[model samples]
Target: MDLPTTLAEKIAALSDGPGCYIYKDAAGIEIYVGKAKNLRRRVASYFQARDGHPAKTLRLVQETVDLQVIATDSEVEALLLENVLIKELQPRFNIKLKDDKTYPLLAITREAFPRVFCTRDRDQPEVDFFGPFGSAKELYRAYHFLMRVFRFRVCDLDLREDDPGRRSFKPCLNFHIKRCSAPCTTRVSQADYGEDIRALRAFIGGRNKGTVVSSLRERMKRAAGELRFEDAARCRDQIQAIDRLKERGRLRDYDEPAAPTIDIHAGMERLQAHLGLAAPPRVIEGFDIAHLQGTHVVASLVQFVSGVPNKDAYRRFKIRGEAGDGDPGNDDFAAMR
Candidate 1:
């Protein structure tokens, strides 16, 4: 199936990088939105084979007359951007998530002390919904994990900052167990609780993630310095949880078949041919840099042997030089060098 000349040119010029792609119909309406780790390869795959693709995919390709791509710094960013676009655009070929009964959403209630919980009821008012997550179980797990870290209220109590009744109200077991800050009992101030809620929102929304992690690290260090071992431990655990969240965004459990096993030697031969190498390359190394709002920049390198990750060969480096000074001092090119 040959693509239109213009579309083919666009495909040829696509970056071999992580991004989201949008397929537009003849009327210039978006019909489908998808993410890919390699923009060129993934987009090209759609045009290359029509034999094994589902009927819906074939139809999507047929209707698509234009293409658009938004590149991201990483694959995780691409995944998050794809989710936001799918929700906002409601593309024709994308799965419908408007039915509240079908998928679960993580809602943060609009109250003095906002309650974070998972719900299938989208009709609820005065709430911010994070997802129509692919799995209710995974959503619930994330909800629990977030509660553990943020310690936001999960109760139905009408908490007001100046509510006199809160002074006398007994806190629940969650407060005693340190799972909640007991905003209902006025044990935690509205301002501090609000800050936690804001951090939670930013973390889930995948914005300022580096800042969040860095803030947690500082809190952990301060707690340790003050001999507050429990607080320090809690902060440490929160940091680890945030790292896991970064690694697996939203826990999207797709009901797709498992990927077939790779043939290492065949893959190596293909890789050699593709790169015009004299012999099949056995080792490949990849590098990425991370920083907190351009400070504390660090780089990581990972090795792949025979098309498989060699975790033992992974290394991390603390970037040094004049680039690490001043506010917002991140220099990707200098760091790479």
Candidate 2:
């Protein structure tokens, strides 16, 4: 089949980047909206030899008189844009997401001490949604994970800053269990809660992971300097959680199979051989230290017996030596020692 000159030229000029593409008919009505990590290759596939193409795909190609592309910084952005466009345009080819219920979004309500939850309702006013995630299971998994990390309020209580009852209201079990920050009470101010929401937004929007982690570390250091050990610990925990989330995302991206179970005795023999030890080491110990700018320095020691961790032998120590009179310095080696 001969290609239209204009279509061919547009395809030739397409950027080799992540983006969403829209296919339109003669009437300039959008028939399809699709996302691609490589816009050029993906869009070109539609115009290739049509012999093996599906009936629906062939129809889509035949009817596509014109097309448009919107490039994005990354594939995640492209996916998000594709979802929004599909919902707004109701493109004929986007059958999978024609109904909003097909994919769920994580929404953050726009209010004092905003609420974060998973929903299929995109039309909710004053709400910002993060995703049309791959599946309900994945969406809920992320939702729960984020809730655990952020500790935003899960309750539907209409919390207001000026409400007289807010200060007197009793916090729920979520607060006691450290699941919710208890914004319903006066403990968490609107401004402080807003910061948490903003951080959550940046995280879910796929912003630079390093930047978020760096910001949290700085907060941890500041809190530690102010002698707010609890606040510093919270920041430290959030940073660790973000690191775990990033690692999880990387594993998911690779879609790699789980590693086979380790052979404890064989592994111990190999380790002993590698180290040229006199015997296959029956006991091994590892030490690591955590600190916020040298303040609140803590070290953990884990023991392994025959290549398996011995949970009962684990110990945690507070590095009192590093906590000098008024000033502290990051001396990880000393703390470990």
Candidate 3:
């Protein structure tokens, strides 16, 4: 379809920064909302040939008659705003994302030996919930990994620090396998158990991660110094595992601030000057590949305005069967093409 003169003008006027864009139909009703790092690039893509576009996208482009944009300071801010707008507008083409209820949260219950488990409920105010993870299997993998490394209790034995008889209780299978700290039999003291839980909390929060790792390193050195090779080896293994997980970017800190407070305009000016561009890159678009091994691959396009993410302009595409090799997987170059 040929671009309408009015729509073409709007596209040409789009700023090259991070922000969200809304698509409206002929009746002036919103049809789609998307975020982009570069508004001009992302919005312009819709008007381009529909050869590789998704069926839904093609249809959306055909129906769009107007565009609306909202610029933000940071990508994280844009994401938060986009989520809000999507929920409020419920545009026809926008995919409904799962909220907190659909995902499981890793919670630490308020008890003497706090029970850590995956839960759907936020029933108790005292209980700390770490996440509402999208993938339960992946979440469990992380949880189990932490359990093995930290040896925190998993069972609900109602054991308390004040209970004198707790020491006589038999250890469970997890305890025997060294997967648990054996709180039921008091093999690990309350102080030590609390320390482990605190460390675990720090790790989950994504704050003080370096501190936790540094502590582990120190412990490893001390263990080796005492000629406790087994303990030292265990520390080394745990450290390596933690580092691997960090490298994979599996751990996310939802509570962490998106970015420090800074002069966004100044940053843009500096970037402009450094790149020697005609104008500051106020709006930008980003692309990433998502996959489970080589299967179920997809591509995501994100928009940013003034270096802030615009979640509303975000777009996702399922890799077409023909785009992949004989085996299904992520083909980043092919997807980009």
Candidate 4:
């Protein structure tokens, strides 16, 4: 590929609209994928020798093999297509976005007596999961608080009730530490455990929304009025649970948007007049390339669920092909297969 003599001349030649543009290197390998509101102007930016562009742009101008474009109705559509193309081809140059941390997740199994605990993977099949929690310690503190307040199980469920090897009278260490409700002791009935699990879900969801706190105080007053010291002790624990919720709220505010219907996938409307075609596919995968002085070019994929970035489903690729001379070609359309 050879450099086109004049940069402004190319801009004067482009038609304005939504589309994908390709930039190639000297050997004619595409190294970058980009979208444009106006083809000519967008393409010309790279060729502006005096524009003080970055090294990537400079390389783009020097080795750009050819120009290609695909006109679309809108920039939004162009953005959608841009993401698709870059991901498939993994063009040498593109911005990268990353999310790479595992936090404690709450998982509740589908059973007569469900268990609640922290997990990291969001892909558990039979359990409900919440969170890509920010920090393990914060999550653990929250986990332990929930366990103490909720009295749910905190030990392995694999041991059989009649397993001969199992100690008939021995309780797990966690039970001794007050982390477990000592369910293994047979002292906790299934019905009672079920009640605890329900309360826990409500607490984690932050419902009762301070109602728990108010209820506990009222109960403590009633118990004290009746001179029932044992009932008052129970109410005190509820008060502490309220305090735990307050502290956790300060870190991860549970002010989530109204939860989406798990059934409906976004962008899957059955009919739309604008498309003049079938409903657009709801699932979208966005691709991006990021480079640092052409030294490290990274490709990224962002998976969207209902037009929202589900950060848990993201991946990044390190690019090495055609990145050396700094001019990574940007043919996103070809990458779109």
Best by TM-score: 1
Where is model 1 more than 4 Å wrong at Cα? Answer: 3-21, 24-29, 35-49, 64-81, 98-102, 134-138, 160-187, 214-237, 246-337
**lDDT (tens digit, per residue) of candidate 2 on 148-243:** 567787555667999987776666555665656777777767876776677777666543456667877887898799887776777787787766
Per-residue lDDT of candidate 3, residues 99-118 (tens digit): 44766677887777876776
Q: What's the lDDT for all of these models?
A: 0.72, 0.71, 0.67, 0.54
Query: Higher-TM-score candidate among 1 and 3?
Result: 1
Q: Which 10-residue window in model 3 sums to the lowest lDDT? A: 249-258
lDDT of 1 by residue, 4-109 (tens): 7888899999998877899998889998988887899999999886888999889988888899998765555565567678888898787665444668787889
Displacement of residue 3 (Cα, Å) in model 4 is: 46
TM-score of each: 0.51, 0.48, 0.43, 0.36
Best by lDDT: 1
Model 2 C-alpha RMSD vs. true structure (Å) is 15.9
Ranking by TM-score: 1, 2, 3, 4
Provide the lDDT at 234 for model 4. 55
lDDT of 4 at 213: 59
Please give the TM-score that candidate 3 achieves against the real structure. 0.43
Candidate 3, which segments miss by more than 4 Å at Cα? Answer: 1-100, 219-237, 243-337
> Comparing 1 and 4 by lDDT, which wins?
1
Worst 10 residues of 2 by lDDT: 254-263
Any idea what lDDT model 3 has?
Answer: 0.67
